[model samples]
Target: MNQHDFLIALLVFLVAAVVAVPLARRLGLGAVLGYLIAGAAIGPFALRLVTNVESILHFSEFGVVMMMFVIGLELEPRKLKNLKKSIFGYGSTQLAACALVLGVLAALLGAPWQVALVAGLGLALSSTAIAFATLAERNLMSTPAGAASFGILLFQDIAAIPMIALLPLLAADAVGAVPHGPPAWQTAGKAVAVMALLVVVGRYLVRPVLRFIARTDMREMFTAFALLLVVGIALMMDAVGVSMALGTFVAGVLLADSEYRHALEADIEPFKGLLLGLFFMAVGMSIDFGVLAQAPGQVLGLVAGFVVVKTLILALLARRFGIARGQWLLFGLLISQGGEFAFVVFGVAAHAGLLPPHMEALLVLVVALSMVATPLLLLVFDRLIAPRLHALSRRKDDAIPPQHNPVLIAGFGRFGQIVGRLLYSQGITATILDHDPDQIEFLKGFGFKVFYGDATRVDLLEAAGAGTAKILVVAIEGMEDSLALIDRVRARFPHLKIYARARHVSHVYQLKDRGVEIFEREMFEGSLMMGRRVLEGLGIDPADARSVALRFRRHNIQAIDRFYPHYRDQTKLVSLARQARDELEEMFRQDREQRQKQEDAEWS
Candidate 1:
C-alpha cells in the first residue's frame, strides 16, 4: 500500500478502537469483542475501508508473541518447574482427548481423514490472548482455574510447532506425492539447537546488554532494545520452525530474575496492547461474511458444535484435576474457543491441497465466530451464573467454632506466620484463620491449630472471636481483602483494636481513610534496614547508619501524614513530595555538620 493509504488505514483503526472499545466495555462486553466489532464494520465485506486483511493479520500476530514474553517474565524457571505436572498432564490430556474426539466425529460425518485430522487439531487449540485477557480483567490469574488455563495454552503453543511440521506429510499422503523438505530428525535437531542457543544468550548475554543500555539512561533506547530482543528471538525461532511465541517466552523466563524485568514489561506493554487489539480486529475482518450469509446454519452450527464439545471435555478435565467445583464451568468456558493458530493451520492446509478453498474459508469463519463468542459467553456467566454460584457456596460454607483467644490473626501466610510464631513464643496463642485450603493443610502438618475460612466474611470474623479479642491483625495479602476485613471489624466490634498490613503506600492511604492508624507497609521496614546496611558498608559508622535509618523512617511517616490531604491532587502531591525531599536532605546535612563539629571539638 502507498503511504497515504497506509495513513488512512491507521487513522481508521485508531478511530474505530477509540470509539468502540469504551462502548463495549461499558456494555459489559470486553475490549476484545469491541475490536472484533470494529474490524467487522470496517472490513471489505462491510464498509470496505481496508481490504488487505491477510497481511495485517500476519503482522499483528507479533502482539501475541510479546504477550507471551511478558507472561514468561512473570513466571521464573522455578515457578515453571512447579507447573510441569499440570503442563504435561492436563495440557497433553486435553489436547489429545479433544483431537481424538473431534477427528473421529469429523470422519464419521464423511470428511476425508486428512481434513478431519487437520480440523480436529486446529479446533482443539484455544486463543491464548482472549483467555489471558479475560482472566486478567477479572483478576483471576492467580486462581487455580487461571493457572490450569495457562498450562493448557502453553502446551498448545508448543504443540503447534510439530502440528505445522506434520501438515506437509499429511498433505503428501493425501496426494500421493513425496514431501520435499529437510528430514524430520534434522528439523528436530535444529529446533533443539536454536532453543539451547536462546537459553545461553538470554541467561548470560542479554542482561549485560540490557544493563549497558539502562546505564545510558535513555528510556527510548532501552525500549528499542527490548523490542529488538523479542523480534530477533522471533526471527530465529521462525527460521528453525519453532513457534515465535514459544521462543520469546523462553527468553522472558530467562530474564525473569533480572532487575530489568519490570522495565522491559513496562516498555513493551503499550505496544503489546495496541497490537493485540489490531490482531483481534484482523480476525474480525477475515471472517467470511459472504460464506456466513450463504450458509449461515452451517457456519453457526460448526461454531456451536466445537464450542460445546470443547467445553464438555475441559469441564471433565477440571473435575479430574481437582479444580474447585465452583470453577468447573468457568475453567471450561474460558478456553473452549478456537485460537488464532487455527487460521494459520487451515490456511496452510488449503495451500497444500489438504482442504478445499471453500472448506478452509468455512473453518476460518468458525474459528473467528468462536473467538467472538467467548467474551459474550463469559459476560453472561459473570453477570448471571457466577453470582448464584457464589451465593450457594456462601450458604454451604463450614462454620468456625467460637474461640476466646486474646488475638485473632487472619491470613496465615508468611507475613502473618511471623506474628503468630512470635505471639506463641511469648505464651500468647492467637486464633488463626486462613482461606487457602492448601496453606491450611500444610500448616496442619506442622501441628499448628488453624481454621480454614474466609476472613472477609463477618460470620467467620465473629466466630474467630473478633468480638472478644483485644487485637485483630489483618494480614491478608490482597489490599482489598485487608481493607474489607478492617471495615467489617470496625463496624461490628468497635472495641477491637485492628492492626493491618499495607501492600504499598496507596494501600496505606486507603487503610488510613478507613480509620486504620496501626498499619505497617509490608516491605518498608525490611527495605529500610537493607538501605542502612548498604550505608554501613559504604564506610559510615554503624551507629550513625542506624540513626540515619530511624530518622528517615520518621520523616517518611510524617510526610505520609502531611501529604494525605493532597494525595488526590497530583500537582500538589508532586510539589509536596519535592519539598519533603529537600527538607529531609537539609535535615541530614545538618546532622552531618553537627557530628563533624563534635569530632573536631573532641580532637581539640
Candidate 2:
C-alpha cells in the first residue's frame, strides 16, 4: 500500500476500535476481544478495509515491549525480592513441565525433535498481558494465585532471553549450517555487561536527568524522557541481539525504586494501552481463515488440546500449592493462552527455516484463538461456576462454628499483632484472619489463634464470627482490602464497632467517607513521637513537648474531617489545607504567648 493507503488504513483501524471497544466492554467482552473482532471484520477475509497486515504487525510489536516495561514498573524491587522463591521455583517448574509435555505431544504428531522443542517452548508461554489484566480487574492481584501467576509470567519473560538465543541454534541444525553469530559465552557476557550498564545509567544518570526535568515543571518533557529511556534501552538490547521487551523490562526494574516510578507509569500508560490494542488487532488480522478452512478439525483440536492440557497442569500446581478454589479456577483459565512472545519466537523460527509456512500459520492461529477465548472462559467461570462453589464452601464452613471471641482482627501484620498482643495481655480472646500462610504459621507458634483466609471475603468474616464479634480491628496492610472489609461490615453488621488504620491522608478520607469515626492514621502517632523527640532535641521541656503533641493530635483530627469533604476537588482541598495550617500555627502561637505571660507574672 502507498502512504495515502496506509493513512486510510490507520483511520479505519482507529474508528473501528473507538466504536467496537466500548460496545464490547458494555456487552461484557473486554477490549482485547473487541479489537480482535474488529480486526477480523476489516481483514482481507471479510470487509477488506485494510490489506497490508504485515507492516502493521511489524510496527505494533513494540506495544508488547511497552507492555513489559509497564509491568516491570508495577513490580518494585522489594516485592520482587519477596517473590524470588516463587518466581524461580513455580515459574521454572511450569516452563519445564509444559515444554516437556507439549514437546512430546508434538513429536508424537510427526514434528522433528528440533521443531517439536521449538513449538513446545513457544507455546508453553502464557499471555502475561491478559492474565494480569484479568487478575487486576477483579482485585485479586494480592492473592496467592495471582502471585503465583505473576511469578510464572516473570519467569517466562526471563526465559525469553535464552529462548531467543537458542532459536538460531535450532535453525542452524535444521538447515545444517554453522551458526553465524557470536558464541554463546560471548553473547552471555555482552548481555550481562549491557544489563549492568543499564542499571548504572538508570540509577546514576537517568534519575538525575528525570529530576532535572521534573524541577522544570514540564510534564510533557518528563513524559518524553520516560519514553526516551524505554526506547533507548530497547534499541540497545536489540543491537546486542537481545529481545527489546527484555531490555525495557530490565530498565523498568531498575527504575522501580525511583521517586518518579508512578509518574513514569502514568505517562506511559496511554501509549501502552493504544499500542497494545493495535498489537492485538494485528494478531487478529494475521489470522488467516483460509488456512483454517483447509484443516478445521486439526486447528480446533490443537487449540482445545493445548488449552485443556495447560489448564490441567496449572490447576494441579495451584492445588498442590494450596491456592483457594475460586482463585485457582480463575488463574488457570486466565493464563492458558499463548503469549505474544510466541509470535516473536515463531517468526524467528520461520525465518530460520525451522518451521514450514503451514505449521507456523497454524501455531499462530492457535495462539490468537486461545487469547480470544480467555475473557469468554473467565466470564463463564465468574457467572456459572463461582456461585455454586461459593455456596458449597459457605455451607461446609458453617459446620464448624468458631469459638466465641469478642474481638476479631482482620490482619495479623505488625499493626494488627500489636493490637492482638495488647488484648491478649488483658485476657481478651481475639480471632485473627490473615491470608499470609507464613504469618499465620508464625502466629500459631506464638499460641495465637489465627485463621488463614482473606478477611475481605464475607464467608471468611462469617466464619471468623463477625456476626457475633463486638469489635472489628482492621489493620490490614492494603488500604483497598481494609476499605472493602469495612464496607461489608457496615452493611452486614452495623452494630460491630470498627477501629481501622489509615495508611495516608487519602486513606483517611476514604475511611471518614465510609463513617469510620474511630480510624487512626498508621503513621500519625509515630510521627507525633518523632515531633516530640525533635522538640526535646531543641531543648524544649519534655512536659511542654508532650502537651504540644497532644494538642496537635486533637487539632489534626478535627482538621481531617474538615479537609476530607473537598479531597476530590484539588483547588478547594489546597485552599482548605492552607487555611487549616495557618489556623493551627496561629493557635499554637497564641498558646505559647499565654504561657510566657503567665511565667513572667509568676516570676514578678
Candidate 3:
C-alpha cells in the first residue's frame, strides 16, 4: 500500500478502536473482543475501508512480543520458582490432555495423523493476552482462578518455543529436512544456543547497559533502550529460526532481576497496550467473512466443537487439580478459545507444505471466531452463571450492629488502628469497620470498637452512621475496595471529610482525581522515617535529619500534586517522577552545602 493508503488505514483503525472499545467495554464485553469487532466492522468484507491487512498484521505482531516481554518481567525468578508446582503439575497435564483430545477429534474428522496433530497443538493454546487482561480488569488476577489461568498461560508461552521449532520438522520433506531448511536436530541445537545466548547477554550485558541508561535520568532514552532490547532479541531469534515471541519472553525473564524492571515496564506498557489492541484489530481484519458465509454450518460447528472440547478438557483438568467449582468454570470459559500463536503456526505449517491454503484459511477463521466469542462467553458466565452459583453457596450472616459515632473508620488494619488510636486518645469516638472476621473478634477482645462488615457497602456505611460522621478514614488494604469506599463516601456523605490512605503514587492520583483532598500514601511517611534514620546513621544530627526528611516529604507531596493531572500518560508521568526525584536530590545537596558553609562560618 502507498503512504496515503497506510495513513488512511491507520486512521480507520484508530477511529474504529476509539469508538468501539469503550462501547464494547460499557456493554460488558472486554477490550480484546471490542478491538476484534472494530476490525471486522472496517474490514474489506464490511466497509472496505482498509483492504491491505497483510502489512498491518506483520507490523502489529511486535505487540505480541512486547506482551510476552511484560509477562516475563512479572515472572521474577522467585515468582517463577513459586509457580513450579502449577507449571509442571496442572500446566503440563492441561496442555497434554487438550492436545491429545483435540488431535484425536481432528483425526476422526478425516485429517491425516500429522495434520491432526498440528491442528490439535494449535487449538490447544489459549489467548494469554485476553485471559490475563480480563482477569486483571475484574480484579481476579490475585485469586485462585487467575493464578491457575496465569500458570497455564506461562506454560503455553514456554511450550510455544518448542512448538515453533517442531512445526518446521512436522512439515519437513520425506528426506527428513525442510525444503532449504536445516535438519531437525540442527534446528533444535541452534534454537537452544540462541536461548542460552539471550540469557547470558541479558544477565551480564543488558543489566549494566540498562543501569547506565537509567542513571542518565532520561525516561525516553530508557524506554528506547527497553524497546531496542526486546525488538533486538526478537530479531536475533527470528534470524536463528526461533519464534520472535519466545525470544522476547526469554529476554523478559532474563531482565526480571534487573533494577530497571519497573522503569522498563512503565516505559513499555503503553506501547504494549496499544500494540496489543492493534494486534487484536489485525486479527479481526484477517477474519474471512466470505469463507464463513460459504460454510456457515461448518464454521459454526468447528467453533462450537472447539469451545466444548477445550472447556470440557480444562474443566476435567481443573477438577483433577482440585480447583473450586466456581473458579474451574471461569477458567474453562476463559481459555477455551484459540490463541494468537495459532496464526503463526498455521502460516508456518502452510509454508512448510503440511496444510493446504484452504485449510490454513479455515483454521484462521476458526481461531478468530473463537477469540471473538471468548469475551461474550465470559460476560454470560460472569453475569448469569456465577451469580446463581454464589447465591446457592452463600450463607446468611448476622446483622451488623448499629454504630453512631462522629468519626467512621474503614479498614481497622495496621494503618487504620493508628488513626483510630489517635482519635480514641482524644476521646473522639470512631466506629471501626473491618472485613476480617477473626481480626474483628481479636480487636473486640482488646476493647476496640470494631465491627464486621465491608465499608464500601452503603448499608454498612449507613449502619456505621456515615450520615452523622464528620470524617471518614479509609485505610483499606485492597486498593479497589478503598477506591470503592471513597466513591461511596463522595456520592452519599459529601459532607464528611474523607481522609484516605493511598498505597502508591497511582493511588494518590486516583484519590486526588476523585476530590479526596486529604490523603497520604501508607508507605511514604514510613519510608521518610527510614531515610531520616539512615541520615542519622551517616553522622548527621538527628534533628537535622528529621528536618531533611520532613522537607523531602513536603516536596514529594507537592510533586505528586503537580504531576497528578498527567497520570494517565505513563511516559509523561515517568518523566515527571524522574524530574521530581532529581529536583529533590538537588535541593538536598544545596541544603547540605549551605549548612556546611554556615557551620564553617560559626567555627571561624
Candidate 4:
C-alpha cells in the first residue's frame, strides 16, 4: 500500500479509537474493549469505510511483538528466580490441567487429536493484560488473589513458547514437501536453538553493549538499538519460520538484566503501545460480523461454551491451590475465555487445514467477542465477586484497632523494627503500616502489628494515625522513594515530626529539607561507634572519652552544616566531602593539643 493509504487507514482506526475508548471508560468499561468495538464498527461488516484491514493486521502484528519486548524489560532475573516455584508449581499445573480439559472437550466435539490439543491450549491461557490492569485499577494488585493471579500469568507467558513451537508440528503437511511448512522436528529444534541463543546473548552480551551505548549518551542510538534488537530477533525467527511473538519475548528475557532495561523499555514503550492498539484493531476488523448474523447461535454458543468450560477449570484449579472459596470463584470467572493467541491460532489453523472454514469463522467471532467482553466480564469479579469475598473474609476473621503510640512506624523492616522493638520495652504501642499482603499475611505467626498500604497514599497514612502521632519514624530504605514519601507526608501532615534514615549525606539533606527534625546519615553511626571504642581502648578515661565523642559530633555537625549546600550539587561529591572532613579533623587535633599545653603551663 502507498503512504497515503497507510495514513488514511491509521486515521480511521485512531479516530474510531479516540471516540470509542472514552465512551467505554466513561461507562466503567476498559479502553481495550472500546478499541475492539471501534475496530468492529469501522470494519467491513459495519460501515465498510475501511479496506485493506488484512494488511493493517499484518503491519500491526509487530505490536504484539513490541508488547512482549516491553514485558521482558519490566521483568528482572532475580524476580524471575524468586518466582520459580510459582512458575513451575502453580504455573505448570494450571497449564497442563487446562490444556487437558480443553483438549478432551475438543476431541469429544470431533476435532482431530492435534487440532483439539492446540485448541485446548489456546483456550486455557488467560489475558495477562486484562487481569493485571483490572487488578491494578481496582487497587487489588497487592492482595493475595492478585498475587496468585500474577503467578499464574507468569506461567502462561512461559507456556506460550511451547504452544507456538507446537503450531507447525500440529499441521498435516508432509515432512518431505514444503508440505506441512517444514517437519515438526525441524521446527521444534529451531525454536529450541533460538531460545538458547537468546539466553546466552542476554546473559553474556547485553549488559556491556548497553553500557557502551550509555557512554555515548545518545537516546536515539539506544532506541535504535532496542528496536533493532527486537526486529532483528523477530526477523531471525520469522526467517526460520517461527512465531515473531516468540522471538520478541526471547529478546525481552535476554535484555532483562541490562541496567539500561528501564530506559530501553521506556524508549520502546510508545512503539509497543501504538502497535498493540493497531493489532487489537486489526483483530477487531478480522471479526466476521456477517457470520455472526448468519449463525448467531453458533458464534454465541462457542463463546458461552469457552467461557463456561474455562471458568469451571480455573475455579477448580484455584480451589485446588488453596485460595479461599470466594476468591476461587472470582479467579474462575476472571479467566474463562479464549486469549490473544486464539486470534493467531485460529487464523493459522484454519489456513493449515486443521479447522473447517465455517468452524474457523465461528471461532474467530467467538474469540473477538471474548476479547471485547473481557473488560466488562472482569467487572463481575471486581465489583460483585470481590466485595462478596471481602465480606466473607471479614466475617471469618475480624480485626480490632490497636492502642495509640506516640511513634507511628510504616514499615517494620530492619529500619522500622529496631525503632519498634526499642519503643516496645518502654511500654509504647507503635502503629505500623505495611501493605505487603505477604508480610501482613504472616504477621499473625510473628505476632507483629502491621497494616497493609502505601504510606504516601493519604488513606493508608490516615489509617496509621498520621494526624495524632507525635513522631513519624521513616525507616524505609531506598533513596528516591523515601524522599518522595517524605515530601508527600510533609505536604499533608505539616505539623508531624519526622526522623528519617539516610544512606548518605545527600539523603540526609533530602530528608532534612523536607522538614524532618532528625535525619541520621546511615553510615555515620558506624564511624562514631568505631571512634568511641578506639578512644576507650587507648586508655582515655570513660568521662573524658564521652566528652571527646560529643566534641567530635559537634565538629562533624558543623562540617555538615558548612558543606551541605555545595554537596547538594554534584560539584561536591564523596571525595570532596571526605577532604573537607579531613581538614576539620586536623583542626580538631591541633585544638586538642593547644588546650593540653595551656593546661600544663597553667599548672607550672
Best by lDDT: 1
Return whichever of 2 and 4 wins on TM-score.
2
As for candidate 4, its clashing pairs are 173-180, 435-452, 435-453
Q: Write the per-residue lDDT of candidate 4 for residues 1-604, one digit (tens) a residue.
A: 6899778876887899899888988987776777788888888888887867777777877886787677666667676676666667887888888889888988998887866876787777776655654565567655656667767776786677556656555673423325445666776688788878877887788778888998998989999998888888888878766667656766786677767888988988899777777766776777888898998887788788888777787788886666767677767765565666666676777776677787777766777777666676776667777787776555221132643667888666776777887888788888887645656677657766777666667656765678788888887766776887788888888878888877886677666677665877767877887888898999866766777778778877887777766765776666667886788788778868976997899999
* Candidate 4 lDDT (Cα, 0 to 1): 0.74
Worst 10 residues of 3 by lDDT: 393-402
The lDDT of each candidate is: 0.91, 0.85, 0.85, 0.74
Q: What digit string (tens of lDDT, one per residue) describes model 2 on residues 469-513?
A: 999999999999899999999998899999998899899888988
User: TM-score of each candidate?
Assistant: 0.80, 0.71, 0.71, 0.66
| Winner by TM-score | 1
Which whole-number lDDT from 0 to 100 does residue 383 have in model 4? Answer: 74
For model 1, what is the error of residue 581's alpha carbon versus the real structure, in angstroms, after optimal superposition? 7.1
Deviation in angstroms for 227 in model 1? 4.6
TM-score of 1: 0.80
RMSD of 1: 4.7
Q: Which runs in model 1 stand beyond 4 Å of their true positions?
A: 22-28, 69-84, 108-110, 132-144, 175-233, 236-241, 250-270, 320-322, 394-404, 408-416, 432-447, 451-531, 552-586, 599-604
List all candidate RMSDs to the true structure: 4.7, 7.2, 8.2, 10.7
